[model samples]
Every structure is written in C-alpha cells, then in structure tokens.
Target: LQLNVFCQTKPTIEASTNIQFSCIQIHYDGLDKQMTAARLNLLNNYWDVVHDFSADESPVANYTLLYEEKAVQLQSAAVFQNSSVTFERSKSTVLSTGNLLSENINQVAILFCQVDNESIVDDPKEPLLMILDIYRQLNVSFVKTVQTPVDAATMRNFVNPRWKGSSKSKAVMAIFIWNCTDNEQNFFNKAISSNNWVGKVNLKVGSDAMDVIDEVYKIIDSNRS
Candidate 1:
C-alpha cells in the first residue's frame, strides 16, 4: 500500500510578515517495530519537526509537519555622505539637488570638466578660469583637467578614429595644452616634435592637485574603455 503525508498552515496576523515552512512524516509498520519507534520518538521534539508519528502494531501511519517562520526584509538610509554626485553636459550644474552642503560629514570632493579650444579661443585662458570658478563656487579643494587631442598623430594614437574626421585640429591642440607643464622636461616629453615648441602653464594648486588629477584620469580612462 502507498501512504501520502502533507502539511499546511492557518492564516495568522497579517503583521507577522514572516515566511513559514512545513513538512510531513509517514511511518510504515511492515518492516519496523518498537526499536524504530524509539528513534522516531526522539526526533519528535526537534524544533524542525512540524509533526511525527508512530504505529501501534499497525501496518501504516501518517503525520502532518510544520516549522517556525523565517523572513527577509531590506532597509536603507538616505544619507548623502554615502552617495555620489556626477556632472554631464546635459545638466546645467555639477551640484545635485539638496547635496551641495554638508552638515558635519567631511568628504573628499572632486571636480571634472571638458573644454575645447574653439569654445574658449577668444580668451585662451578662459577654460582654466572656468574651472577655477567652479572650484570656488563649490568650495572644492581639488580639480582635475583632461585634454582631448586633435592632431593626426594624437588622433591616431589617443582620439578615436570616429571623432578624428569631425574635429581633428581641435583635438590635437587640446592634447598639447593638457600635456604642458612648467617643468621643461615634462613639457619637452609631451611636445609633438623637438622643433614645435609648446607653452606650459603652472596650474598645480595646493597638495590636493595630484589627487584631483589622479581621480580625473580614472574617470577619463573609464570612459575611453
């Protein structure tokens, strides 16, 4: 003969919000006796056992089983210190709504922006000034700048082939400015050729300059990849 066992639960308070699990046990008497019943009896009190059974010289018996409820819930806090802010062309400003000021949390602030030579050609120094303005407005101590090159060599080496056709000249000039620095060796190393002299500007400010540059490089590399 075949025996089947099943278990279920009655509805409880809706606030319980916990998951419930159940199981059932069946006992066969044809090939078992008191010795088997003793072992089964020992297991009856286990927390995991919803139900258990024993047969008194009978061929079969069935029992329903159940288990304690278990549940999982997710919770989070809306603290700005744990969040990040980003700036893109589509947005008018780098500041995110309600995130401009800090109450008591000290944070590592970063600023990143891209500018083309054509956009600031009238005043070649405007790009740097714009960056400075943003730094002052945000009270940020660090700033990192990335220059995209337009020259054929730079285009072939760094700039994507797709962008080369549209603004090849601008990309090369931007790269030239980006690589320039007050140090003669650093400036020479980045120059297009030994004969083509490029001017360098001392833009490094405070101890945070290096950190800002490193962060900006990471963002640029990530975008390129």
Candidate 2:
C-alpha cells in the first residue's frame, strides 16, 4: 500500500480558519483493497497516528475506498503548537472534526488509512514515515529543532540530502525552545555552518508559526539576490 498527501497551501491561516488536506491511498501490494476506515491525523513527537486519529470517514469507506476527503478543519489555534513544541505536548482530544467544517488545519497535519483486510499494514507506521519522506523532499522546510540536544545530534548524524551536494539551494529553518540548552542552541549554528543550503534560520522555541514562515521567506528573499 502507498499513500500520498496533498494540501491546499494558504498564505495565511487564522485560529479558526479552515485549511484543507487531500489524502490519496494506493494499493500496489494487493494485500488490501477498499479502506475499512480512514482519518486525518496530526503528527507529534512519537508521531502517534493510532490514538490521534481524527476526521473519521463517514459510514466508513463511503468514498469508494479511495481514502480522500476535503472537509478537514482548523478547529482551533492551539493545535498548531503541537508541531513546534513536540516534546512538551500532552496527549488529548486536540484533533477532532466530523467533516462538519471547522478551522483545524495548522502548520502540521498527516493522513492515515486502514483497509478492510488486516493481512498487511495494520499500523500507522507506513503513513507516518511517508509524511517524513515528504518533508525531506521539500525545498523549503521547518522542524521543531528537537527537544534534546542529543536528539539534534542524532538528527545531524541522520543528515538531510538537500543540505549536501554542490547545489545546496534549499531553505531550512529550525525553531528552538526559548530555554533550550547551549548544545541545543548550537546545533543549528553548526548545521548552518556545515551545510551548503541557500540559508538557514533559527527561531526561538516560543516563536509563532508565522515567525518561522517569515524567516523562511527572508531566506528565500536573500537567495533571490
């Protein structure tokens, strides 16, 4: 099974304004067909898709088993913080919308699906990893900067492909906590110094989502010269 996600990019998303997501699921392995259930999910520190499932399909697989929907909403402004402060967030009913149309979409959102046949891929691992892959391929990027400096070091070791090679033109910005340790603070500085990408910015942990977006715009503007 393969799943792809496409979103309606917005110039501005308000606290109660709606943002849209379109999820497409394809079955190549043939182990599953006809989605038994589907959902719009939010990504967190553990990327827990199971417990975090929201916007469930009405009547289940009613969409011809394609796993597509257009009614996902922004619900409230607070959910947007989940992406920036990964480790600090607590599990709760942070995401829920029965396709009735509310303002739920924020900086981070993901999709998940379950097929009628449970013979293969019962967990959310595939979809979660798929989103990560999408993030890696993007030319403009944003990451919460990691809760611990050690995690940052681990991420550094993992490396990003766009940050390498001769044509390092992609823009990436890291948002860190205000009280982040010195090592955590230095991670982006070191990464920016070592990477050849167009430019990189480090945002304080408490910075607004718009702040990160603005910094990314600045990097883009600087590179335009």
Candidate 3:
C-alpha cells in the first residue's frame, strides 16, 4: 500500500504547533478485499492510524488525523502581557497566498502579522509586544518565537539572497517586524488591500498597541467565518 498524507495543503508550520491532517490518500496494488483488510490491520497495528472499533457491528473511519509535527526551533519568547492592538477591518484582506511547495503546486491562504516599527532596531521588546498582541487578536495561542538565520558570506549577500529550496508550508497566521517609512507604510497598505491573501497589523513607535485590538479582532473574526 502507498500512503500519502497531507496535514495542510500548504504545510509550512512554526515550532510547537499542532496540525490536523486534512487529506489522506491510500493506494493499493492489485489488492484482494480480504488481503487488503489484513494489510490494513497490519498497518494499523504498526502505525495506529485508525482507532479500534471492533466491538461495534460496523466500524466507522475517523476522518481527521491529528498530527503534532514540530518545526525546527530557532528562537522563542513568551507573551505575558495581553494584546491591545486594533485592526483596520476596512482595509483587511480575506486571505493571503503563499507557494504551497506541494506536489500539485497549489497556492494556499496565509495569515501574516507584521510589526513595522523602527523602534525594534533599538528595543526588541517592542516588536515582541506587537507580535504577542497580534497573536492574541487572532486567538492563536502564544508559542515561542523562531527565526532562520541567513547564512551569507557578506552583508550584501545576506541582505539580498536567492532561495532554492522547499520547506513545509501551512496556512497560518504569520508575524513580521519592519522599520518602515511613511511611503513604505502606504505601499504595505496598498499591497495588502490588493492581495486578499494577507492580513497585516501595522505598529508604530510609542503607540498604544492595545488600541488596535478591536480592529484586529474584526479582521480575524471576518476571516474566521
């Protein structure tokens, strides 16, 4: 039997996150019904993919497969303070797209939370607040933060590098931090509005992050339904 399983169409996942298997496909080569049943039993005994239900006359197959796959840990932090960031629902997108990196090359919706504040260059804690606030707004439980270092020989190369690899992708609420200018913020606004695939939380220096809670909630709520 050939078993192919997919948790999310775009399986990009952060560390310490849980994924529900949404699709599973099994292929058998010239299987007899009796042989297939026995094979399934053997597979179940080894893999435990199916729950035992022999006590009942007929067995029901469970659709969802709970897969807890943790990504490689890079960085982590905890959010103790509650989030008070508000979102501009009028400008929020219903969805965002990312390269699924799957066999079928499908595009999937991705959630992005960006904290474009110059303050983070000096005080990293400020960006953490922004990240935690956005996650709280999205109702995603706080997990340790993680980042992949750009290993380049030179500063220029590190700043502008090309990628040639595939990593697991998932439909998830993402977080980002940028020190943006007024023109850049305008561009970000326009970009997110134009592309329904991404929702952004813009944070400025010294602004009350909690002020955006209602706005953020509205955007997340709209997408939830």
Q: TM-scores, in order shown? A: 0.20, 0.22, 0.19
Candidate that would win on TM-score: 2
Q: Please, what are the lDDT tens digits per residue for candidate 1 over residues 13-130?
A: 2222222433222222321234233332211112222222233333433432222111112233344235432112222122111121233222423222222445432222444344
lDDT of each: 0.29, 0.27, 0.28
User: Residue-pair clashes per candidate, as listed?
Assistant: 6, 9, 21
Q: Model 1, poorest ten-residue lDDT window?
A: 171-180
Over 1-225, each residue of candidate 3 has an lDDT whose tens digit, in order, gives 122232211233223122333222222333324333433211111121233333243343323342232222223323312432212221211111111222311111122233233333223343334433343333222212321221223211211123221221111123222334466456545555544324333222212222222233344445445
Better candidate by lDDT, 2 or 3: 3
Which ranges of candidate 1 are over 4 A from the true structure?
1-123, 150-225
1 versus 3: better lDDT goes to: 1
RMSDs, each prediction?
29.1, 17.5, 21.1
Q: After superposition, how far is residue 143 of candidate 3 from its true place, in Å?
A: 4.8
Best-to-worst ranking by lDDT? 1, 3, 2
- Candidate with maximal lDDT: 1
